[model samples]
Target: KATMGVIERNGTYEQLGSITTPTLIVVGDEDAATPYSKSERMHFAIKSSKFAVIKRAGHTATVEEPEQVNTVISKFLECCV
Candidate 1:
């Protein structure tokens, strides 16, 4: 509840548009804590951000689908570099 409230009132949303750095936003298709829609919203907020949704994974996508997560991270890093 507290976390949700903080997320709702956080200034990050307002500052997202100002961020010019490359960002990789990854989330699981089945994530309950932070769903795909929320990730999409973040992607839209950050102009230079990339969004990746791992299939058949949950909130702990990195742990549940390490290969997919690593691949996505690697690709993002490659592009950033």
Candidate 2:
């Protein structure tokens, strides 16, 4: 399910950035694919966006550091609310 969901191309990055909706980007310091730099670029491109980095994790930081990732998500969601 996750693979299918991830594979589906909802839209191009530019289109996603063009959206007025707020965006939150979280990346691990060691991510290889969709690296932190890419997330940084995404955040910069989106007018209203926030970005965070997990200190010691890779691509699947949410799984590698659930508590830290949750913390970032919680904080970001709070800002949205």
Candidate 3:
């Protein structure tokens, strides 16, 4: 219910612009629950952020393409450190 409220109220959207920390916005090319456009919006909102789209994957990109997801996250972390 709380998660639904956050989504319905656009709470996270409202707060995205204020984020200053480095962020990695990842989405699957075929994501439906949280579409690619949403991830793009988040990438734009967060000043310091990177966007990655996993090809041939869906909403469960982490589980569907674990290796690709891990590689992207690893690369992002490397840049951060």
Candidate 4:
């Protein structure tokens, strides 16, 4: 099921703008699972989106830099409210 979803993910870039809510997109500077470039593209597509890059981290950025990820998330939530 997960593989199928990955192979055929729903939604399109044209629909991204429909998301009016403020969005926080965090990705590692060296994320291999999903490259940071993809996240940057998403930030560009979403008008209300903010992007953050976790330096010296990879796909598991949250695990590799829990404190940094938490801090970023906290700041995003604070600004969102």
Candidate 5:
């Protein structure tokens, strides 16, 4: 659950706020590992970004609610394009 290594190696967090790409930040309401607030911060930092919260799920929302996750991802992709 620790992304610090990846972030440091890739320098992902260094320029996070500068990224202008269409970003979809998805988080689970019950995600204790990463937490929803961390996802919210990313969404806020990115200029062109969308955020989604899946209920009744933990860190793995895509697995917990496939249909809901797909719908949200589809809608976000559509909107971005």
Candidate 6:
């Protein structure tokens, strides 16, 4: 919680936008901690990034939707490789 506050205060939008590597930003549709919209913004900031939304999941998306998460990650990695 404290770390989140510190990071929020010291937002690194500049560094985020400077990423040259391919990035996959995945978020659960029902995630209250870090909503999909926030991830969407990050996807836009990254030049080579793919954004994925896991349905019927929350903050712990990997736990709640393991298969879906794995599938998304697999697809992203396939493109990367």
Q: How do the predictions measure up, each by TM-score?
A: 0.84, 0.80, 0.86, 0.86, 0.82, 0.86
| Runs with alpha carbons beyond 4 Å of true place in candidate 4 | none
Candidate 1 per-residue lDDT over residues 20-54, each given as its tens digit: 99999999999998888888988999997898989
Q: Tens digit of lDDT per residue, candidate 2, span 1-81?
A: 988887995857767657778788899999998897788988888888889999899999988999999999999989898
Per-residue lDDT for 1-81 in model 4, tens only? 999898899768788878999999899998998798888888999997999999888989999998889999999999998
Taken over the whole model, the C-alpha lDDT of each candidate is: 0.90, 0.87, 0.91, 0.89, 0.86, 0.92
Q: lDDT winner among the candidates? A: 6
Off by over 4 Å in 5: 1-12
Candidate 1 residue 3 Cα shift, in angstroms, is 5.4
Task: Name the regions of candidate 1 deviating beyond 4 angstroms.
Answer: 1-11
RMSD of each: 2.4, 3.1, 1.9, 1.5, 3.1, 2.0
Report the poorest 10 consecutive residues by lDDT, candidate 1: 6-15
Q: Which residue pairs in model 5 clash with each other?
A: none
Q: Clash number for model 5?
A: 0
lDDT of 3 at 34: 87
Report the alpha-carbon TM-score of model 1 versus the true structure: 0.84
Task: Look at candidate 4 and give me any clashing residue pairs.
Answer: none
Clashing pairs in 6: none
After superposition of all CA atoms, the RMSD between model 5 and the true structure is: 3.1
The residue-by-residue lDDT of candidate 6 on 7-49, one tens digit each, is 7796687789889888999999999988988889999999989
Q: Could you tell me the lDDT of residue 75 within candidate 5?
A: 99
| Winner by lDDT between candidate 4 and candidate 2 | 4
Looking at candidate 4, the ten consecutive residues that score lowest on lDDT are 10-19
